[model samples]
Target: MRLEKQQITAGFIKQKTIEKGAALCGIAPIERFINAPHGFHPTDILPQCRSVIVFASPFPISTLSCNTNSPYTFVRNKMVEKTDQISFLLAVELEQEGILAVPIPCAEPYDYWDESRNHGRGILSLKHSAHLAGLGNLGKNTLLVNRTYGNMIWLGAVLVSAELEGDSIDMETLCPSGCTLCLDKCPQHALDGKTIDQKLCREKSISCTPGGGWVLSCNICRKICPANRVIKQNL
Candidate 1:
């Protein structure tokens, strides 16, 4: 925790993140962390803390292809496990450095009867936080789309007692140009110009997903986008 200009080094973890298969990483103050989607509704004042470290690990493109048609829970659990493992390791490393850390994708399961069950959905929003935290911008499909990963990434963060002055960068994401194709491609019309309706999207996909796959909805948005498709062809 050196203190000079910016309280933390922006590129330190950024370098490690690449080797660890992280597509992107960034740091923000605990105050800003609480204000993020991961924090859900933040407290009036952030408690004694330093910064929030964010990381994004790319999910396998094939993982997105699998469906309930497989009739096995192994793949589903594997996806969740891999994501939580990445987040857990980051938190552990922070603790080893004598920092108080909280990992996203918390190990706790939400209770169906508990009112706060809805609150736990903020984990999904953590993807949005990581996106704005310099990982990438939210594509039209509402998934965080990176140059290397298209709607195929997991996000996690750590809260520490170290703040980096001037490290808080502006979340200025450049929207893809003339990319309303995803919006128009939505069969359920869940994506409007401003906000998305998850309920409608999920319901509409039920027809395509048999034996209980529609609960999560389809990703036609990413499949139709030209961003990564162009990169793939060039490669």
Candidate 2:
């Protein structure tokens, strides 16, 4: 009966997340992320964490086609905001169901930062959590390449006390080997084969506040990725 209860809880959460604008949702056991940074682990946020519920919302590829910065910027912000709202709502619903839950933010760096290196890490790596939940895989560009949405997705997560059945890890590789478009197209050469030079990436991709909102200055890596193009074409 405990397993049945967990199953019902997970189903309810997934359905509610979709109704709240998530395009995809999945669950993973906390143990699946044992190798994550100590502070980013589910238990660190909520000591009773037993499962991780991850979700994603797709960004409209058509928005990038416009020359106006407003389209891409607006869609980007909307996607992240929607994902965050879904997670927060799910967390509240889980608590009402008698399960303790903690919602993770879709953006902002919180867990770790190295001042000398000028590098920051997220409290929970949403991309990796989404992958572990079987929503996507890491592409060569280091973005989470969702099977249906490619790299064009916003991710969020919630930690819960229910031990729900977790999704299986995706085994099929999504990136086309030998393709280095993202690396070659990077304006600052921030991408290496396996990792990004965070300092260079930030300098090229992020613009500081002028009036209020920050800007995503450059997006060549996302634009040039073949997988993203494929998704766009199919859509």
Candidate 3:
């Protein structure tokens, strides 16, 4: 009976997430995060967390093709806000149902920052959480590549006290063999196949104009990625 309740709750959560404008959603049990970095676990954020709910909204493929970076940057910021909003609404709805739920910010406003390395960590790593939830596998560019959405998605997550049934982790390899387009194309040489050099990436990827407007000056890695372009062909 307890397991049945978990199943029902999991289904409800996923359905609600999709209804809330997410393109995909999945659940991962706390056990799957056993190796999560210390202090970054679901339970670390919400002591009673028994499940992690991960969801994503597709990035506008059209924005990526624009000549100027402003369109891409504008949409990128909006996606984060939209995903975070979905997580917030989902948490509130779950809490009303007597379940304790905590929303993890999709990005920014994080406490961890290493000035020396120019690195910052989200309270919970949404990409890793999404991978554990079986939404997709991490690609060579360190981006989550979904079977349907490819790498064109923004992630968000929520922690719940319910011990929901977890999704099966995706085992299929999504990256093409010997493809190093993202690595070779990076102007900053920030990617090393398995991880990114945050410091190097930031140096070229972000900038401020003379007028003081913020611009995501570079996206060659994401734009040049073959996997990142797949979604458009399918659409």
TM-score for each candidate, following the candidate numbering = 0.70, 0.91, 0.95
Top candidate when judged by TM-score against the true structure: 3
Q: Cα RMSD to native, each candidate?
A: 5.2, 2.6, 2.4
Q: If both were scored by TM-score, which would come out higher, candidate 1 or candidate 3?
A: 3
lDDT of 3 at 187: 86
lDDT of 3 at 82: 96
Give the alpha carbon lDDT tens digit for every residue of 1-235 in model 1: 5334333355655564555556667665545544453335222123554666677665445434455424223343555676577667766765665555566663245322224322225432555555545566676666666666655556666555555432445354434666688789898798875467756764654344455443444656655766555345544
Q: Per-residue CA lDDT of candidate 2, range 22-85, in tens? A: 8899998988998887687878788898999999887888876776566687788887788778
Note the residue pairs that clash in candidate 3. Answer: none
Which structure is stronger by TM-score: 1 or 2? 2
Per-candidate Cα lDDT values, in order, are 0.55, 0.82, 0.88
* Model 2 segments more than 4 A misplaced: 1-7, 208-213
How many clashing residue pairs are found in candidate 2?
0
Ranking by TM-score: 3, 2, 1
Clash pairs, model 2 backbone: none
True lDDT of residue 54, candidate 2: 95
The candidate that achieves the highest lDDT relative to the unseen native structure: 3
